[model samples]
Target: MKALVTGATGFIGSHLVEELVGQGYYVTCLVRGDSDLKWIENYPVKKILGDCLKHEILHKLTDEFDYVFHLAGLTKAANTNDFYSTNATGTENLIKNVIKYNKNVKRFVYISSLAVGGPSMDGVPLCPCSPPNPVSEYGRSKLQGEEAVIRQSDEIPVTIIRPPAVYGPRDRDFYMLFKMVKRGYLPYWGKSFYSFIYVEDLARGIANSVKTEKTIGKTYYLTDTETYSNEFLTDTIASELKCKYIKLRIPKSAIPFIANIIQKLTKTSIINSDKMTELKHTHWTCNCEDAVNDFSFKPEVTLREGIKWTANWYRLHKWL
Candidate 1:
């Protein structure tokens, strides 16, 4: 099998590439010129330098790959349109080319996000058939990407995988809290319920979707089938780090100011006003029943075990 993966250097995408290669698939990765190659540099995969927004670059590829994993998209941006430009329009560009050229492609898997479906209704874990109500620009852009895959479902075989706040090694978002724990501060927002998946488990589920015949034209959430509260998250990290810390409760109203200060100082989107829109919600959980029944998708890593591994990796790499 031949697989073409976009966003191959990212946290999740790199793991997906590793999984695909382990499955004996010949892999080709589409990457940007400025993308960091440290994660995927040693992989036995071909890398093609290209930007997804540029149709000319994507058009140059031959129609030979058996599978296409479209994981390329902007999670944070300087402007709202940038998210749409890279996530939505870029997805459409790829899907169009796949239909125009890759006639033999068996599956075009779009790795989406739980944000695309918004928070669950009344703390109920959302299913694939739930109506979408994206709360942030990033979520809206990913929803657009999902729509492109669904809109062209009849034209080609495609599957969508929506993952929640994924965490594990090489993850920077969740690392903020871990860092706080290491610094003798345990920060938490609220008692809000949210879902998360280990990167390795998510990668396995994604690979299963690529190989399964039952996933065509279907959307699935690939979580660990657990909804964790903010308190639980803090407690887990605190226990893993074995730290003593002050309890810090971040006020939702102050997030915008903190976002500005962080962006100005670090120029990172780890915290942003738009992302706060999603954070303000009380529930962001989803179930993975469809994935469980269809492909026997099972998440082996629990929250505690995953946290231990993540903290260990950060320590070994001097990132903590």
Candidate 2:
């Protein structure tokens, strides 16, 4: 089997590429020439330089691959339209080209975000059937991407995989918390129930979606069996790091100011006013009972084990 993967250099996408190669699929990765390649540089997979938003670039590819994994999308943007342009329109472009050119493609797996479905109500885990109420611009854009995939259901055998906050080796987001804890400060925002999945387990579930027949034209939420709060996660990471840290709880009202200060200092804003909407939401837990029953998806790494491995990786790489 052959597979084409976008976002191949990203934290989750790189892991997915590794899993695909290990499963004996000849893989071709679509990435921008400027993308950081350190993550998958050791892998012996074909690489194509292209941008999903540019139809001309995507149009150049031949439909020789048996599977297409669309994982590329803008997660952070300075404005709402940028997110839609990249995440939603980009997905539409890819799906359109796949349907137009790839005749033998068996599956087009879209790796979506739990943000697309928004926070669950009353601490309940969101199922796929739950009504979406995306609060952030990024979430709205991701929901657009999902709708784009669903629009092609008649022509392409697509499966959508929505994963919650995913963290593991090579992850930059969650690693920030680890760094903070190491520096003797554990920071958290508003109270919220969050869901998490280790990167490896999410990759496995994604691969299973490709091989599983029942997942066609269906959506699956892949997450660990536990639901936790921000404090719990912070505390767990501190425990895994074996560090002492002062608890810093930034109130919801102050997130916008903090976001501005960070953006100004870094000259880049991964978090902004739009992100505050999600931070203030009370729940982000999702139910994965369908993934468990249909794809036999079981998350093997608990939060403690995953955190330990991630912290160790950061230390070894001198990122701490």
Candidate 3:
């Protein structure tokens, strides 16, 4: 089997690339000219240099592939237009080029976010059947990308995988928490609960979706079937760090004002008011029943085990 993976250098994408190579598949990585290729440097794969937003590049890159894993999208940006251009337009461009040129492509797996569904309306876990109520520009743009891909389901096999708070070794997003836990200070914002998936588990889920016939035209929420509170998460990290967990709970109302001041002065906003509001809203859990039933998806690593592995990686790399 031959496959093309976009965002091949990203946190989850890099892991997926490694898995694909290990499975003995001929993998082609679509990356920008300036992207760092250190992760997959040791792996044997074809590297195509081009930007996803460029039509000529997409036309050239979509030539011969059995599957396309559309994982390239902006996760965090200061400007909203950057999100729309990169996430929405980039996806449309890829789909258009694939339909026009790559007629033999059997599967197009899109790596979307759980944020696309926004917070749950009640205490119910977010499912594939819920209507999207995206709150941030990031979420909105991802939803737009999903719509674009779904429009091509008639001509191509498309599957969407929405993962929530993925973390594992070499993950920078959750590395901050590991650092805090190492320092014996674990801070949390709200009393809400959220779900997570190990990066390896998510990568395997994506690969399964590509190989499974029933996954086409379906959206799967790839997450653990466990919900954890912010306090519980902090404690787990602290336990893995072998430190006394010092919990610091700040008032939720003060996050916006502090975040705004930090944004104005340092031009670095860690957690904005809007993000805090989303955090306080809680119920960010997701149901993985569909993925499990269809693809035999099961998260191999427990939360504690994953955290220990992440903490060890951080220590070895001197990141903690």
Candidate 4:
């Protein structure tokens, strides 16, 4: 089996590449010329240099691959147009090329975000048929990307995986939580609760689902069935790091405002107003029954265990 993966250098994509390789698939990483390869440097995989939206470069991009995983997407931008340009148009371009050049590929798997489906009402896991109500431009663009892929499902086999807040070793976003815990502080914000998955668990779920018959034309939320509270998350890290922290619940609405102010002062896109749009929500859980029923997808790590492992990695790298 040959697997082609875009965004192969990213946190989740790197893990997926390793998973595919371990499963006896020859993997090819589709990465940009300037993309950093530090993450996948140890993996035995082939690399093709190109931009997804560059038609000439993406020609025959999926040739000879048994599966194609499209994980390349813009998660943050200084402006809204960049989000649509890369997430929506770039995704459309890649899928169109796949259908035209590699129609015989077994599956074109798209790794999407839970943000696309927005927050579940009253903190319940979302039903698969729940109407999409994307709260952020990032979510809206990703939904458009999902729509583009679903539109082409008739021409090529496709599976969409909407992964929740994923964290593990090599993950930067959640690393901040661990850092705060290490410093004897558990920053609390509102009643915000989330569904999360260990990155490896999500990668395994994606790798297993692609070839399965039922997942081909469907979308699945790859997440731990359990939803996590902010308190649980900070406490877990504090325990693993052998640290103590003061915990207090700040207003959830207050966090986005602070984040916006920080971004303005730093002029950094990382914590911009766009991301705050999604952060303002208190519930972001999703149902994983479709993935479970369709592909027997199971997460091997408990939150406690996953957090411990992440803690160990941070320590080893002197990041904690």
lDDT of each: 0.88, 0.87, 0.84, 0.87
* Residue 227 CA displacement from its true place in model 3, Å: 1.1
TM-score for each predicted model, relative to the true structure: 0.96, 0.96, 0.95, 0.95
Per-residue alpha-carbon lDDT of candidate 3 for residues 41-128, written as tens digits (9 for 90 to 100): 8899999987879987877755679999989998766566888999999999998888899877899899999889888878788989
Worst 10 residues of 1 by lDDT: 261-270
Model 1, residue 167: C-alpha shift (Å): 0.6
190-275 in candidate 2: lDDT tens per residue? 66788899999999889988777889998889999899988788888888878889878788788888887776675435556776
Candidate 1 lDDT over 89-183, as tens digits, reads: 99999998888888668999999999999997688999998999899989999999999888888888999999999999999989888988778
Tens-digit lDDT track of model 4 for 162-258 = 9989999998778877887787765465657889999999999999997569887888898888988877887788888888998756677677777
lDDT of 4: 0.87
For candidate 3, the TM-score is 0.95
Better of 3 and 4 by TM-score: 4
**Which candidate's lDDT is highest?**
1
The list of candidate 1 runs beyond 4 A from truth reads none
- Give the lDDT of residue 236 in candidate 4: 83
* Candidate 2 Cα deviation (angstroms), residue 188: 3.5
Task: Give the distance in Å from residue 283's predicted Cα in candidate 2 to where it truly belongs.
Answer: 1.2
**Each candidate structure's count of clashing pairs:** 0, 0, 0, 0
